[model samples]
Target: MNQYVIRPVRGDEWAKVKELRIVALKDPAASVAFLESVAEAEGRSDAFWQARAEGASHGRAARQFVAEGPGGEWAGSVTVLVEESGTTDIFDQHIERAQGHLVGVFVRPEQRGTGLTEGLFQAALEWCWSLEEPALERVRLFVHGENARAAAFYRRFGFEATGNVVPVPADPSAKELEYAFPRP
Candidate 1:
């Protein structure tokens, strides 16, 4: 049997969503792997999380998938944001094509290296390619240059560095490398 149930998060699971994000922010590599801090996430009101959950749960613009263990524990999560062509991204950068941007990726420490992370990516990428109206051309993700482990994983997962780099907002000295996976 499959070790985990991988599916999009439900709209009503806001509390669990908040809890998992808080946990992710506390991870040892959070400073390099994530853009948000625990303080920033915790300071947000419950209403904000509710809205986020609802939006991701049912929208064509975004989707959040979680891998749950048989014991009902969340093993990891990945969120994909669809960016339409001719629009700017969250960083105010111009997007040349309709595509999926993978973000908010997190897997529990114990779940790492057990193929759980691969499962999460597969689910997210599958969803991205399944969109038809705009017909996604590719899926991309940004990895902090300092985060070597994540960068390696993306490379192994068939995402190639696109020669794009963006300055990390909190620390201008650091950069995030852009990697892309063309639609199959």
Candidate 2:
């Protein structure tokens, strides 16, 4: 693919946002790495997409970035959500301090090896590092244990396994490995 522009997703572009997410959920690797399925995303209403985009576009706790192809199609996307101290139930971990959790990372299969993932991470991390006082101390993500390709890429990006593994909620027999990038 040609060089694409990576930028924050606009609040009003929720329809495109929903479309891209459905496409992402259809990828082969989605079964192992992503939580949602294409059918599920496809069934959501316009209101769902509108709310999601609005939350990420302006919410203080999260941000979403998209990579746009030369012809204006969305090539990829990544979202980061801030998990603050005292939150419970999702991941069931008590936060000792503020941290940014990377999630919803998806890139088109054709765009896999073009350094787009790196650029995506740079954009996500820059946003994480831009947080205000009592600033973020680290960024983390959980990868499926069976996804060796993703795990290796995370390592290449400076994230280290924290020796913490959580069972995937959808598949109890599978485990997700947590990796962290300590803030400098």
Candidate 3:
């Protein structure tokens, strides 16, 4: 049997989702690895989290997958948002093709190097490719340039840099590097 049960989070699991997100934000690398600050996340209303959980739980446009450990704890999570062709993404960049953008990736420090990330990415990509209405051309993720560990992991997992660099909104001196994996 698989060591972890990898699955999409149900709407009823909003509390757990919220708790995990808080833990993720407290990680030492959260400054470079995540766009939102811990305070921002904490300030969000419970209603907001509930709605987010419901939306991601039922939509093709977005999904949040979690890796549930043997003890029913969440070890990691990855959220994928589908960007449609001809629309601007959250960053205001024009997207030329429908694709999946991986975000909110977090794995517990203890879970790192245990293949939990691979399991999360596998589930995320599989869901992306399974969509038929707006077939995704590729899956992409941005890594903070300063995050060498994450960048190396993405490369080892088959993502190639697309030569695109965007300045981090929060830190003008830093940049986020784009990496992509084409649909197979």
Candidate 4:
């Protein structure tokens, strides 16, 4: 069995984070799996990655969970961002409550179905609900309409479709389906 550890990433690990993210963007499923492209991410400055890593480190409102293999390779990663009530989200939608929005989900092809994805999510969700000053009302994620594999995993994990669909800003012809796990 492959051993792995799930934990929060640190500010100095920006290089590895950038490397993994760029690999994710190059994946064949990138168009539907991520909102950003390799060209776009590659164009970003080192300072951007530095801030991204720093902001997503432990104790930050946005946290990135990494699944590290025994060899120190990152098998997968997921990020959860806390959105305060009445604030505008990435899509400019008004958030109705303090909530956790799941994003940047990715796993190495070899790591898929090995429970690494679940481990990454568990860490992210634990951190989300642990917040007290602004208690979270739910955890949510958006899957591309045609991404059945991801949709199935989310459903299996207890997420239910909200019947809410939004146009993918990057591809106006395509849409994204909303899924959520309300605090239980």
Candidate 3 local Cα displacement, residue 74, angstroms: 0.5
Write down the worst ten-residue block by lDDT for model 1: 1-10
What would the per-residue lDDT of candidate 3 be over residues 45-64, giving only the tens digit for each residue? 99989988887897788999
lDDT of 2 at 172: 83
RMSD of each: 1.0, 1.3, 1.1, 1.0
Whole-model lDDT per candidate: 0.93, 0.88, 0.93, 0.91
What TM-score does prediction 2 earn?
A: 0.95
Between prediction 2 and prediction 4, the one with superior lDDT is 4
Spell out the clash pairs found in candidate 1. none
Candidate 1 lDDT over 1-184, as tens digits, reads 1779999999998998999999999999999999999999999999999998998998689999999989988878999999999999977899999999999999999889988889999999999988998899999999999999999999999999999999999898999999999999
Which portions of model 3 miss their true places by more than 4 Å?
Answer: none
Query: Which residues of candidate 2, in runs, are more than 4 Å off?
Result: none
Better of 1 and 2 by TM-score: 1
Give the range of the ten consecutive residues with the poorest summed lDDT in model 3: 52-61
What tens-digit string does per-residue lDDT give for candidate 2 at 66-182?
989888888899999999866752668778878899999989998998888888899999988889876899999999999999999999999999998989988889999999999
Q: Which residues of candidate 4, in runs, are more than 4 Å off?
A: none
Clashes of 3: 0
* Candidate rank order under TM-score: 1, 3, 4, 2
